[model samples]
Target: MDHVNISVANNEEKGANVDFDYSQRAQWLRAAVLGANDGLVSVASLMMGVGAVKQDVKAMFLIGFAGLVAGACSMAIGEFVSVYSQLDIEVAQMKRDHITNHDQELAEKENLPSPFQAALASALAFSLGAIVPLLAAMFIDSYKVRLAVILAAVSIALVVFGAVGAVLGGSSRVKSCVRVLVGGWLAMAITFGLTKLIGSSGLQM
Candidate 1:
């Protein structure tokens, strides 16, 4: 009877471990979904706003197409550079850990390996997570109002999502969200302002 109980306990532990692995995988999916959602929401909103101002369907379509193309390329480049920098930081951190471990061994200090491994995993996870949204947002339809809306929405959402990520990683959620939101809006404002400026120079048809 004792053996049976022990066997059952071990099986439960194994099941729990598997469950954890599955849950961890879900984080990647969350990132992907958020990316797509961002693209759709922002672009849609932008399209609606522009459509309100300019009833010329052709102009709106061109503007949206241009925005989508520009946003996707910018996102990709931004993500690549951002992730590359993160990778560098992670490498530096790992190197520091290695040196610390070596020093500890020399001085007969003791610590567990688990902490170092955990840190490494976290850094990699963050870097990879940053890329998913950019890629997903690149799918905005070209030459369509929907494309414009999607690109704008995704851009904003990605910024917000990044803030949420910072919070999840134990940072101040309000601060992170506010900072990202402000920066994102500033960018959108600049884009719209430039578009309007260019549009205004033309004779009112």
Candidate 2:
């Protein structure tokens, strides 16, 4: 009787509180952040490069649009394939675990992966990010102003994305923001420099 009471007390104590895990959400958040970062950096870099070579508004806008569409599609497909493979492996493992060990508790504990949701998040995030540079280039008529606006917009976006990623991933916000901002600036600088050099060398494109 005493042992039974002790066991009951222990059970009650163990059930006092539950921990909510954010690790799963973190995985999808990571995918979304990557997509957004890629969209912002790649499209911005492309625009900066094109602007450096030719100040034609139409040419710059066309390239930016093309990049956005291509990037979003690529992000969606890549995320879907990558996460789908992970889901498949997880499902297979779960099946094997059930068959070999008859582990109901383990199966119940393992949450099902959502590749579709992740892919959608990634694609949408990419599109949303691509819009920033596109919008900056679209509304401004002056070539120099458009270019400056794109860089400024990208800088702000990188900082914002970094902070968001850090918050979602539970890390240092300032560090994350600075890191993303610096990386984006470097990418734009490199692209612009290369394109400028090539254009100056009498390369027609």
Judged by TM-score, which candidate is best? 2
Question: Cα lDDT of model 1 overall?
Answer: 0.50
lDDT tens string, model 1, 82-190?
Answer: 5456556755766667765667554433222223333333334333333333343334444354435544555666566666656445467777666656655664566
How far in Å is the alpha carbon of 49 misplaced in model 1?
Answer: 1.3
Q: How far does residue 151 in candidate 2 sit from its true spot (Å)? A: 0.9
lDDT of each: 0.50, 0.86
Measured over all alpha carbons after superposition, the RMSD of each candidate to the real structure, in angstroms, is 10.6, 4.6
lDDT of 2 at 121: 85
Clashing pairs in 2: none
Task: Provide TM-scores for the models.
Answer: 0.42, 0.85
Per-residue alpha-carbon lDDT of candidate 2 for residues 1-205, written as tens digits (9 for 90 to 100): 9999999998876655222335556668888899899999999999999999989888988998999999988888888888789888977876777655557655654676677877888888898888899988887889888998999999999999999998877789999999999999999999999999999999998
